[model samples]
Target: MEIILVVSFSYLSGSIPFGLILTKFFGGQDIRKIGSGNIGATNVLRTGNKFLAALTLVLDILKGYIPVIISLQYFPELIQLSCLLAFLGHVFPVW
Candidate 1:
């Protein structure tokens, strides 16, 4: 039960499309329509806003890291699974 919650939380957190949201909000561009069509920092760079891309990179990393950190601190047994799910969510997001 606890494992399910931890993995789900980690995946959901990592699945957030930070690059897409930031670019659309600040540059009014759909990130998916530009460059690599990816929702990562590299794709965000296509918007010509280094600051937004950098922010997206940082947030993306934190999304993956924070969940692992939380799982380690509160559910050490789930650290590996949580991290794996987070990566998968980022690469193949549900959203």
Candidate 2:
């Protein structure tokens, strides 16, 4: 289904652990073991790169918002239902 594909793509995008990668590739620390130990925005700040963490937060919000906007533009009302599920998928990835 087109809707399924759209949500799947959005979740995939959101689930990308940018903070984790930044820590590993650049700082050689697994961010998950640091301060708050979350892969999300707040924990990233503990890495001492406030700018990068802020950027990641903005980008993460956009990662959810953009796909929802696109789905709305094309499919309208259905995006409301789908976007939340997609966002949840990102927050708690099973894949």
Candidate 3:
């Protein structure tokens, strides 16, 4: 149960589309329609808002990093699963 909870948390955290949210909130444009049409920081940069892009990058990194750190501290045996789920969540987010 704890493993499931941790993995779910990790995936959900990674699935947050920070670039899309930040760009839309700050730039008033859908990031998906921007340059590369990607939801990552690289595409956020295309919006010409360096601060938003950097912030998105940091948030994205933190989403992944925080989960791994939690797994390391609370469930070291789940580190690999946590990392994989986080990546998958980012690549295939529910949102």
Candidate 4:
């Protein structure tokens, strides 16, 4: 049950779509409608907002990193599953 909860949290966190949220919050054009139509930092960079791009990159990294770190500290046996789920969540986000 604990592992289930942790993995679920990791997946949800990774699926946040930071690039899309940042672009929209900063009053920029929809990131998905521009360059490559990806909701990643590279696409965010195409929006001509370096700061937002960098921020998106950092946030995206954190989303993945934090989950693994949590698993490491509290659920070491789940580290691998946590990492995979995080990546999958980012690639196939719920949102």
Please list the C-alpha lDDT of all candidates, in the order they appear: 0.91, 0.76, 0.92, 0.91
TM, every model? 0.94, 0.82, 0.95, 0.95
Compared with the true structure, model 2 gives a TM-score of: 0.82
Kindly list the per-residue Cα lDDT of model 3 for residues 1-95, writing each as its tens digit.
Answer: 98898889999998999999998888789999989899999998877889998999999999999999999999999899999999999999999
| Per-residue accuracy of model 4 over 1-95 as CA lDDT, tens digit each | 97888879889988999998998889657889999999899998887889999999999999999998988999998899999999999989999
Candidate 1 minimal-lDDT segment of 10 residues: 39-48
Candidate 2's C-alpha lDDT? 0.76
Largest lDDT belongs to which candidate? Answer: 3
- Model 4 lDDT at residue 53: 90
lDDT-wise, the better of 3 and 4 is: 3
Model 3: what TM-score?
Answer: 0.95
Whichever of 2 and 3 has more TM-score, that candidate is 3
Rank all candidate structures by their TM-score, best first, as comma-separated numbers.
3, 4, 1, 2
Q: Which model, 1 or 2, shows the larger lDDT?
A: 1
Model 2 residue runs over 4 Å out of place are none
Better of 1 and 3 by lDDT: 3
- For residues 1-95, could you state the per-residue lDDT of candidate 1 as single tens digits? 99889979999988999998899898888999999898889888777889999999999999999999999999999888998999999988888
Two-way lDDT contest, 2 vs 3, winner: 3
Task: Write candidate 2's Cα lDDT for 72-92 as tens digits.
Answer: 888776787558766786788
